[model samples]
Structure formats: structure tokens, C-alpha cells
Target: MAISNKVYAMPPVVDANSRLLFLGSMPGTASLAASRYYGHARNHFWPILYRLHGAGVPDASYEDRLRFALAHGCALWDTIASCERKGSLDADIREAVPTDIPGLLRAYPGIEVIVCNGGKSYETLDRHHGMHPEVLRRAVLKVPSSSPIPTRQHKGLEEKAAAWLAALSPFVKPRGDAQGG
Candidate 1:
């Protein structure tokens, strides 16, 4: 791969109150270009989050969407810190450097769940830090990818949202409620 193919992940969106850590494999081309997580118009990440929180629609601006997630104790990040890949697909990824998840877990002890956003993110996390004590203690879930690409099991936005909700409901709280309901 050319040097130009090397893509780096954005800094994690986290805070002291964050209790749900959502991790993707890495940012796709659209996300990288926009300098935001899940920037693709068709991507289901934002929509699913909004639906989970009972927010009728996602906020038009990226910053507002981010704030909403933070308000609900959701933290967004990627498993891969940097990697070389020709395109957005996880299969194209090569020379992957994983992010310091354990360090982040240590820093934010309030985080109780680790939700891997897709197969690649979970695979990388398991391969790299599966045995770590911090990871072992948390509720780690491998959910379907929020990518626009459809699979046999998850073909539509609603399907994806349902799957994500099933995995996240136990940890997620209502929009303004700090305590889990």
C-alpha cells in the first residue's frame, strides 16, 4: 500500500460520565474525509443511536449528534488507531495498529460496556486485548456493522437498529436520565 493509503482514526469522544464505549474497526473514507465518525449519509450509526434514545431524528449537525450520545453516556471510538487500506471496507485493512482500549478503560472506570460496532472491530479487539483484565471485566458485545452495506442477516436500517438495541438496551439510559432504566 502507498503511504497515502495510511489512515488514522480520530480521537475518542469520551468523558467522565461515559459508561458505554462503542468501537468501530476504523473510520471509512467518508468519515475520514469529513473528520467525523460515521459521516456517510447512508450509514446507520447515527440513525440507530437516535432511535435507541427515542430521539425522533438525528440532529443535522455532527456536533449535536455527538453531544446527544455523550448525554446518554455513550462514548464513540475505533479499535484500530491507524491502518493502511485502499478503501472503506474492513477487508481492505492492512498493517493495523490497535488503539489503547485498556488505557481508556482504566482512565474511565465508569465505562461498563464495550460494544464492538462490527465484526472487524470485535475481531481486532479480541486478537489484541481480549485477555486484558479491564476488557475481561466489562460486558463486551459484538454487534452488526453500522455500515451502509447490507448483509443476509441485517439488510435494512431497522434491522440493524433492532440488533444494536438488543445488545445495548441493558446499558443505555433514556436521553436525559443519568441512571439506567
Candidate 2:
């Protein structure tokens, strides 16, 4: 496939109450086409999140899902602000421009943890903004990609959920508990 022209990431889904920031590499082809994060049908992102938080169904409307995430103090964004790539694979990204993570952190001081959704997101954060004082102060968790593509270690949704839950449970409260009684 020919490399496409520069593709930009969608604006972050964040707010003052956001306590956990989830960073993906960039929107995949399906996600970009649909203008929704983790839009692909096979991706485990939504399912994992719903399973972990147990509030909304994974099949809920896009807006509902976004609200669910935000209600749980979770924010979502991509590490790469813009890049050229032939397809959805992270390896194909070129001329990558990183998102202003430090700026986001500064704006949302409530965010206590940064969760890299995959290796590319983690690598991008580490390579581009790791040294920033804002980034250095927060906890960063590198979790397995929630993609449907199987790996030797994380071979299915259950495995991915286990890993994600383990990494995020301390910070992500269920919807009922998120608002704080």
C-alpha cells in the first residue's frame, strides 16, 4: 500500500476530572474512517474497558462510550498527533509528530497515571517526551495492545483484559465508585 498523506489524530477526550490518560499510537484506518477512537470491530479496547469498569455496554453509542470513559476519570488520546502511513500498522508511521502530552498533563493536573495502550504509544512517549518534568512525575503503565491481533503472550481478549485490569485497577474505579460517594 502507498503511504498516505499526513493524517492527523482527533482531539483528546479529556477534562478536569480526568485521572487516567490512555494513549494510543494513532487512530487505525477503521478508527480514522469512523472518526472514533478504537473504532475497529475487532479491537479489544472498548470490550476491555467495559469489562473492567462494568458500566456501559461495549455496543453502546459512540457518545455513550466516550461518556462512560470520561465518567470513570479516563481520558483518551494518541501519542502521534500526525503521521504518514500506508495502513493502520504502527511500524508504517513516518514523519511522526508527537502530541503535546506535557501540555495536557499541565492542563489536567488531576491525571495521576498515563497508560500507553501499546508498544508504539509507550515508545513514542518515552522517546519524545519522557524527560519532561510533567511526564516524569506521573505513573506510566505499558500495557499490551488491545488489538485483536494475537501475540505469543497475549493471545486473546481474556488475556488482554487481565493485563489491562491489572495495570489500571488501582487507578480506574468502576462507574459507581468513580464519582466518589
Off by more than 4 A, model 1: 1-3, 176-181
lDDT per residue as tens, model 2, 51-131: 778654585689988988887788999999999988888989999999999999999999999999999999999999999
User: For model 1, how many clashes?
Assistant: 0
Clashes of each: 0, 0
lDDT of 1 by residue, 1-181 (tens): 5367899999999999998999999999999999999999999999998888878789999999999999888999999999999989999999999999999999999999999999999999999999999999999999999999999999989899999988887777556655553
* TM-score of each prediction: 0.95, 0.93
Kindly provide the TM-score of model 2 when superposed on the true structure, using C-alpha atoms: 0.93
Looking at model 1, the pairs that clash are none
lDDT of each: 0.93, 0.91
Cα RMSD of predicted structure 1 = 1.7
